[model samples]
Target chain A: MASFLEFRQVTVAFGDYVAVEGVSLALAPGAFVSLVGPTGCGKSTLLNVAAGLLAPSRGEVLLEGRPLKGLNPVAGYLFQQDAILPWKTALDNVALPLVFRGVPWGEARERARVWLEKVGLGRFLRHYPHQLSGGMRKRVGLAQVLIAGPKLLLMDEPFSALDIQTRQLMENELLRLWQEDRKTVLFVTHDLEEAIALSDRVVVMSAGPRSRPIGDFPIPLPRPRDVAEIRLTPEFLRLHREIWELLRGEVLRAHAGA
Target chain B: MRGLRVRLWQAGLLLGFLLLWEWASRTGRIDPFFFSLPSAIAQRVWRWFATGEVYPHLYITTVEMLLAFALGTLLGVVFGLWLALAPAVAAVLDPYVKALNAIPRVVLAPIFTLWFGLGVLSKVALGVTLVFFVAFFNTYQGVKEVSPLVLQNARLLGAKPSHLLRHVYLPAAASWIFSSLRTSIGFAVIGAVVGEYLGSAAGLGYLIAQAEGVFDTTGVFAGMVVLMAFVLALDALVGTVERRLLVWRSKEREGGSA
Candidate 1:
């Protein structure tokens, strides 16, 4: 398949601190990719570059065949934090991008209601962010991003803030959304299991200040795989162990540097 | 029911203070000339209302307040957004703006009257000056405080600079704007009244000045009471608008719970 998104020899820096360097990757359309590493391994920074939030200092990011000059409105991003507007009702929060795009209030609200219902938050449409539980808030955040109907979705440790049970549920919810939308996804996380569970390909990065991808592994898992089933699969365990083995030394190196 | 209880307690305290004042004045323990009995003030108020003379003065003050408030808030929001979004401009003007705000606004009444004349314009100018700083600082802080994470997420979602301003910056500043509005109410009233006091042929402040000159303590107290009632009503109106606009605020959840 032709690459839909390409990062060509991308490097990112903040003043003197180089976050990512000499990182190159290409994602096919409708592909699900995850970047896994210890904290500060520049996984999120790489995602930022791909999303065009940060310009690569020494390389170019291309969406399709064109250079990505700035942020791509055709893309959606879910942060580690829910980032829901605390003053907006769940329905309004979900409808925000539409509203900004000049959809009238009545129509935007109706569309928002449909998406909120999809996330099972229809009854709590009028509830504020603080009123919802952590899981519910994350779902609302998901709905907000998905309502934009972007071609590519970028998530940075989106489930890390939730408890184990909630994280599992959210992971399943995300997988369902991915299946339904068939959008290209670039998810950044530290959890090896999560990376294996959700991604078609997992990219592991070395520790910063000039971190680059050290390994990339493709998971050959069947669709609609359950968490429990995936855990028991020898293939899943083998991929998990391999990724962990690559990450462990880098993690130790990061600690030593710190 | 809880709201009712709170109002009942407020009323009770007001009545107790009135009774104490009435007893003190009637028993010759305090001078009624300076601190008029509540009953006498109420009678004066009733006379003014029955005669329909209070409305014109009330109307004058209200118009001045509303005009000043609208103008001040508009300027504050615009300038605040400019200062926050433009770092170089903020850096160049910050100290001067702080010094201007620190000067007591009441001291500007004479200067405003001299510049704008003895008409409603002077009062509006004075009121605007008083209301402007409160709103400006709050809005500045609000815009400045927008989460870096939210901005990053929005940018990744392909939000243009204008989109970031409209969706992210403005909403983040709204809560601050609304909060500053509560204080701006008092400033609006003060501005109008002080302007009238300095030089005006009309408004509640003029009535109070006239009453004071004539030694009509009851009339003076009645004028003050009118001003107080008007302020409270205006504040309630602002509160109502805030509640409607910020319906998604967590405080609204408390309202629903109640």
Candidate 2:
């Protein structure tokens, strides 16, 4: 498969403290890939580099055979914290990307209304981010990112703050959305099960101070999955066990280093 | 019911304080010549309103206050955004900004009066000097505190510099700006009144200053009463605008009554 995004020996260092070093990875178009790592393993650093928010100290990123420069133009990022503008209502928040693109207010609003309805927030078009529950805000964030229709989706632990039940629901929602178009996804998280459940492939990073990918595991699970139900399946358990064996050592190493 | 009780108590307290003052003056418990009776003050104020002698002064003062408030807020936001976004400029001007802010701004009233001549322009300049720092500090803090994640998300969403300013930076700073509205407005009023008291020929402050010159305590007290009412009205107006603009903030976070 042709690579949609390819990182060639990317290294990021802040002064003398190296966050990640010589990490090279690639994602095929429409592939759902997750980078799983222990705490402080710099999984997020790689995602930032991919999104072109942070420049790698060395090496380069090629997006669809071209060298990526500045911010990746065709990506939508869902942050770990509430990223939706607090001053805007749900409808306006979702419409902002289109508005930035010079879409007329009336037309953007009409499109936003449709998107909100699709995200099961039709009644909440007028609600602010603060008015929504945590899970609901995540839904809005998801809708806000998806409305722009980016070819690549970069999520940095987007649902990690939610309760387990809400997290699972969001994972399923995400899977459902991705199935519709299968835009290339680069999800970064510490939760192994979550990475395994949502991703077609899981890339694990070693502990930090110069973190790099140590293991890449193919999930091989059947698609259209319910994240909760899939966890109970034998294949899923086996994959989890296998990945955890590799991941446990890195996690211990990180803990000891810290 | 609790709110009604609180309102009633507030009204009762004001009524009692007025009655005490009236009694103290009428019975000559204090020198009535200096501390004029509240009834006399009320009568004077009513007569000024009935004959329409207060209109011009009221209009001038209001114009000065509004011009100062609007101009000060606009300049504050623009400069605040500029300084915050440009780190090098902010660093270079940090000491100058601090030194300027440290000066007792009231002293500038006389200079402004001399420069602009005892007109609305002088009063507005004084008011702007007083109002600017509050708005600027709030805006600076607000813009600086904007989440890195949010900025990255907007960038990933294809926000240009202009779009980020309009949608992200401005809105992020707005909450802080709104929070400082009452404080800045109070400064504006002080600027106008002080400018008038020091030199202007008209305005409520001029009326009070003139009464003080001749020892007409009733007139001075009447001017004070009118000024109090003016400030209260402005405060109420600010509250209405804040509620309207900040509808997206949760009521609880806004610290509104339950």
Candidate 3:
């Protein structure tokens, strides 16, 4: 069977700067993958390609055997930033995707309320984005992306700014939610530990000017993994060490380049 | 308690200033002919109000102000969004917009009188010109400056063009557009009155012009006072609307960033 999404020989350039080069990757339906790389190593550019936010300067992005165009209809994106509209209350922000999808306002709001409750933001219905804490806003962002039920999820370091405790809690929440139906996810982050803890496979990329995947490691961890508990295991540590070895060199190169 | 204290201070300051002015004019510290005694001005204003002579002029000026405000704001938002969304079109129009903005729109009062005649049409036309650019620039900036990340997330979540405009563009621009509306209220009123002052059959501007021609210092002062009152009332109206519409932002200011 065809992989649900494919990035074939994708290269992205902005004027004189080449962000990503000759990158080919595939994701099976329901797979969870994390792309780990150094800062400015084209992780976000790659993610944007998947989201169809930026067309690759070279190569094609295919979704379910179709060449994707404009915005990818099958995917939802969670930005590194909260991305929740500050002008909207938590409930309204979560309901925004549904409203865009032509759902009736009443039903969209009802579903958004349920989703917000699921994300543990039941009491923050009327609270604006600014009123909520960062974690609360992130939860709102999660509810916003998930409420629309896109088949593929693209998250760009969605929790990199959170305190560790909040990060772990949100990671576990994401896992629990994703487990209800194993949705395909493409998560990008610089943190190797985070990559290994949350994803079924971790792909490491070299530093830019022409960043491309250096290694792909399929995680052998068991299902129903607790992100916090799984970290204490030797297997997680070994995988972390191995991925860090591959990633640290690229990070150093990026730092030198900067 | 704090708000009341501030209001008390404001009232005291206003009363003190008025008393000082009244005392100075009455005691011949300043020439009453040019400065105009505050008491006489007050009496003149009262007479206009009591005798209902101000109504027709007020009505004409207000209609011109409202029409200018409504038309300018609508055109500004629509055109601003269009230009922001279509960069190519914006590029073409960029020079023209800037050139129009650079010219003092107040100077167009005379030209508007020639184009639209010595009626409310001329006044409205002048007011529209004054109000448009401020609103347009603000709306353009508001739309242009929407967080690209937020926009990307919206698109990935399946927001279509129409949905993007309603949910993202308008809400992002809401505060800016409203700010422009508030600022342009003063300009609109100025435009109408200035146009009328230049040449007109009826309006507060005409009344002021009539007073100025006869060197009736009290009438001029009263007209000035009436114009001030009109502007304050309109500003208050806008302030009320802003408070209601931007309730979400108010919550943001009160809440600390989480």
Candidate 4:
């Protein structure tokens, strides 16, 4: 099958500093792919390239066999920080993508209402981002991105700010949402366990000044895995050890450089 | 109950101050000729209202203030967004913006009167100058500080330039603009009154200046009191609008739990 999204020898640099160099990645349609790396590993830069927010200095990103010239036309990005409009209610924020697409106000709002309910925020339609808890805001963010119905979902450490318990719940929530339609996702994170638990294929990236993917591991874990309960399984532990062994050296190198 | 208590204390303080002033004037502790009795000022204000003598002056001042504020805010927001989004232009115009901002805007009142010829336009021009910087600086900062993550996410979700401006940029800058409303209104009042005080056919400032010319201290005191009341009313209106527009921020401060 043709890749839904492909990066061809992509490189990004900030003047004298090269953030990522010669990085090539691909995601098949409806696949769950996680890009994991140590701090400062250019995971976000790669994600930005895929989203077409930042054009690569060297190579290009191809979406469905065509080179993307500008912002990706069929992608939704969930940022690490709170990206929802602070002035808007949850309902308005969720309705925004539709609104931007020139959807009529009434119909867009009706659809947004459905999406908000799907994310379990039926009672929070009128609540502002500030009024919602960290986890609730994350749910709102999820609803916001998914409401747009993009083919490619790009998430950059979206739940890193949440506590451990909230993180697991959000992880499970993400999985549940992904299971419904299984849209192609390029999720970036530093958490090894999260990558193993939520992803079908985990791609590890090396530390920067010049960062690129160093290893790719395919997880043969069973479907419908619980993020919290999966940790105790023997197979899960073995995969964690194998990936962590390769990830630990790069993490130490990043720490020493910092 | 706490709000009511605070209001009662506020009213009590005002009443005590007025009573003391009236008593002191009556007892010959202070010369009523220069200081003016509180009762005399109150009576003057009452007669002006009853006979409708102050209506035209009040109308002129109100119109001028509103025009200046509306026009200034509009121009400020437009120019601010324009310059902030264009880094090359912003760098080129940096020194000039600082220089213009540094000049005492009050000095421009005389020039404005001379150029616009002491009508409502002169006051409005002066007011615009005063209010413009307050709105401009706040708006400039607001646009410049919009979250990069939000912009990126919006683009990935298929927001065009116009869509981003309407949905993201305007809403982001609105908080900053609303915050500066009170300050800009105050500047508007200053510009209108000062322009009229210098030279104008009608306005609250003209009334005060006319009274001072003839040494009618009571009329001057009455004018001052009316002006104070007018400003307070305008401020209260601004407070209402701000609360309505920035409900998200206020809720954030309240820390409403999800």
Candidate 5:
């Protein structure tokens, strides 16, 4: 079977400083993979390479078995920071991708309205990014990405800024959304619990200045798991301990270097 | 009702100031020759309106200001975005832009009047000079300061270069440009008025210059008052447009950006 996405021996460097080195990763069709790493582990750099925002110093990133050049058009990216246009209302922000593609304003707006409703922001369509809570802004960001219906989704520490409850709610919402269409998602996070809760496969990365995958664990948890409830299960606890053992060394190394 | 109360308070404050000024002038406590009584200035303004003498000059001044503002802002945004995006151009032009900005722009009024021959064109040319740098620098910063994450996200959502400009760059730059609006528009009015003062036969500035020549302090004061009101109205207009365009700025409830 053909892989949906592949990063072949990728390395990213800025001048003499290497951020990531000799890292390779691949995703199967409709797979959800979480990349777990310590602080400054260059997870974002890897994601950028996949998104085609940054070019690899070595090797190549392939999307759907083709060499991806410039930006990968088959994907949507959700950033850790609020990336919604502050000057545009929630509806307009969600409608932006379609508008950029030369869709008529009225039709795009209608579609954006529907997406906002799906994200539970229908009542606040006219509100700006500033007027929304952090959680609300995250919902807008989610709707903005999903509105385009991309083949792949790249999320970099997307829920790290949220409180635990909001984070779990967003994670559950994400899982529900993912289950419906099954788009390939590559999620980056420092949270082991989040990784275990949300992903089919959790790939553990070592700390920088030469970050690489140290372990890849396929989750055996049943389908449609609630992000909050799954944490209490013995199976989830066992997996957490196994992953944390590998991750703890890297986290300590990152802290000592910092 | 709250808005109305605020307006009423503002009106009362203005009336009180006028009354105090009138009293001081009538009692010969202050020299009315230079300061000019508020009543006299008001009477002069009222007479000009009643006799329909202010219309032609107001029309000419408005035309010059509007033309200069539109032309300067358009060129400013285009060139600013270009320079910011193309690093080579920016590197080459950095010192030159600084040098031009350093030159006291008011001195250019006589030169513009000389080149464009003391007409509306000359006034507009002078106005453009004052407005261009302000709009340019703000727009440059606006485009330069766009979050890398936002740009990457926009690209991953399938934005072309042109699409990026329309959807990402322009909207990002717009808030900065709008912030510069009141200042740049003030410069436009100043340019028109100054150009008229230096050489033109018409406009509010010309009226003040003519009054100063004949030693009619009331006419000069009336012209100044009119100019003040004119700018206030224009600034308010810009505020209205900004509110309409920047609707997304109002919703920042909390800091949860995912």
Candidate 6:
């Protein structure tokens, strides 16, 4: 199978501090991949590099064999903080990508309404970011990216701030979106269960200043998986243990660095 | 019922103040020559309006105020957006803008009359000067305070620089701009009145100056009442526009409360 996205020996730096060093990874088309690591392990930095928000100080990022130069609109990003604009209604926020692309206001809003409905926000289309609960805001944020119809999605800990129940519900909603759209997704999170529950493959990273992937574990669990049922599986437990073991030392080292 | 109660309370307060003023003037506790009774002022205002003496002055002041307000606000928003987005430009112009803002703008009325003549132009110039800084500073602060995370999300969504400005920066700064507009209304009125006071043959300010020269306290009070009414009307119009544009915002608040 051909690689859809490639990060070849990518190194990202801010002045003297290198966030990611000599890191290499490739993702298949329409694949669900998760990067699991301790906080500050540069998972977000790697994602940023992929999204072309940060310039790689070394090596190259290729999208479908073409060198990525600037921001690629084909890649949609969902931030950890929801980042829905406080001034915009849920529908308007969802339609923002279309607006940026110069779609007419009436049509863009109509399309935005469609996406809001998809994310179960049909009733709250006129609601602002501040008006929505945390879970609903996250859903709105997801709808924002999804409405753009990007071939690749980059999510940075998109559900980290939500409560456990809401997180699970959001995870289910995300999985449903992913299943329906079949877009390639690169999700970054520290939750082992979440990584195991959602991804086709989990890339585990060591701590930063020079963070790189230390393990790549394939999740063999069948698709259309329920969060509760998946957690009950021995395979899920085994993968969780493997990832936890790989991440344990890195987490400790990150704490020590802090 | 709640809205009605609030309205009743406001009306009662206004009536009580009017009664007190009327009592003070009728009882000779306050000099009617210097401080005309509210009833006398009202009578004078009615006669002024009935004879169409108030219309020309009202028209003159309103035109000057609206023109100055539009010109000042447009320039302020443009310059403020420019300064906030460009660090080098902001650094270079920061001191000059601050110095201009800090100076007493009312002192410029005479200079404006000298430069633009004793016609409407001078009043407009004065009003523009008064209104500009309030809008400029507020818009500058607003654009500068746009959340970094939101900007990142926009970039990730493939928003071009212009798109970012239109969808993110402008909307982010809108509430701030509206807030400044409310303040700028008073400044705009001050600018026009000050210019007229310095040199003009028409406008409510000119009427007041004439009344003061003749010791016609009723006429002076009537002019002030006219000015106050005009300002309040303009403020109400601005408020209406704000409510329309911010419909999405209030809906969000309602959703949150529910």
User: Residue B11: error of model 2 in Å?
Assistant: 1.4
> Docking quality tier of candidate 2?
medium
lDDT of each residue in B13-32, candidate 2, tens digit only: 99999999999988989999
Docking class of 5: medium
Chain B TM-score (each prediction, in order): 0.94, 0.95, 0.95, 0.95, 0.94, 0.94
Model 6 clash tally, residue pairs: 0
User: What is the TM-score of each predicted model, taking all chains together?
Assistant: 0.90, 0.95, 0.94, 0.93, 0.91, 0.91
Better of 3 and 6 by DockQ: 3
Quote model 3's TM-score: 0.94
- Writing each residue's lDDT as its tens digit, candidate 4 over A205-251 gives 99998999999999999999899999889999999999999999999
- For model 2, residues A1-258, the per-residue Cα lDDT tens digits are 889999999999999999999999999999999999999989888888888989999999999999999989888888888888777889998998898888998999999999888878999998888888999888888888999999999999999999999899889989988999999999999999999999999999999989999999988999889999999999999999999999999999999998
| TM-score of predicted structure 6, chain A | 0.97
Output candidate 6 Cα RMSD. Answer: 3.0
- Tens-place lDDT per residue, model 4, B1-258, is 999999999999999999999999999999888989999999999999999999999999999999999999999988899888888999999999999989988898888878999899999999998888889888888888888777777777767899888877877888788877889988999989999999999999999999999999999999999998998999999989877766777533531111
lDDT of 4 at B131: 86
Write down the lDDT of every candidate, Cα atoms only.
Answer: 0.87, 0.89, 0.89, 0.90, 0.89, 0.88
List the candidate 3 regions with Cα displacement exceeding 4 Å: B1-5, B102-107, B250-258
lDDT of 3 by residue, A1-258 (tens): 689999999999999899999999999999999999989889999888998889999999999989989888878888888887777889888888888878988999999999999999998899987778889999999999888888999999999889999999999999999999899999998888889989999999999989999999999999898999999999999998888888889889999999
Q: lDDT (0-100) at residue A230 of candidate 4?
A: 97
lDDT of 1 by residue, B1-258 (tens): 999999999999989999999999999899988888999999989988999988898889999999999999999999999999998999999899989988888888888888999989999998998888888998899888888877766665545789788878887888789888989988899999888987899999999888889998998889889888888998899899987877665753432210
Off by over 4 Å in 6: A105-114, B1-16, B250-258
Off by over 4 Å in 1: A99-114, B1-9, B158-165, B252-258
Rank by DockQ, highest first. 2, 4, 3, 5, 6, 1
Summed backbone clashes in each candidate are 0, 0, 0, 0, 7, 0
Q: How accurately is candidate 5 docked according to DockQ?
A: 0.55
Q: List the residue pairs that clash in candidate 4.
A: none
lDDT score, residue B232, model 2?
A: 88
Each candidate's fnat: 0.53, 0.89, 0.77, 0.87, 0.81, 0.70
